[model samples]
Target: MKYLSDQMLIEVYHRAVDLQLDSAFIELLRSELDHREIRIAQVSA
Candidate 1:
């Protein structure tokens, strides 16, 4: 996971969500993102 670039990491996260993968797996992705201090923007209505 560390080897993945920031863009790749975010892409993987999005892919996982689109595929409806397991929550644990998704959490792992989030954990990695947090570890790298990468922030994803949130759109509020």
Candidate 2:
């Protein structure tokens, strides 16, 4: 179970993607998500 709602998940993932300043490397990760909200147990920067 997650504390965040669907919209929150979307927002969080977008924020994570935004932090990927390494534009070249981020392409693959972002493409994998494909504009979908990800439900991961935890994300570590």
- Using lDDT as the measure, the top candidate is 1
Best by TM-score: 1
lDDT of 2 by residue, 1-45 (tens): 156555665565566656854655455444444545454543444
- C-alpha positional error of residue 6 in candidate 1 after TM-score superposition, expressed in Å: 0.7
TM-score of 2: 0.42
| Model 2 lowest lDDT segment of ten | 35-44
Candidate 1 clashing pairs, residues 3+ apart or interchain: none
lDDT of 1 by residue, 1-45 (tens): 979999999999888887888889988998998899999853121
Alpha-carbon shift of residue 20 in model 1 (angstroms): 0.6
* TM-score for candidate 1, residues paired by index: 0.84
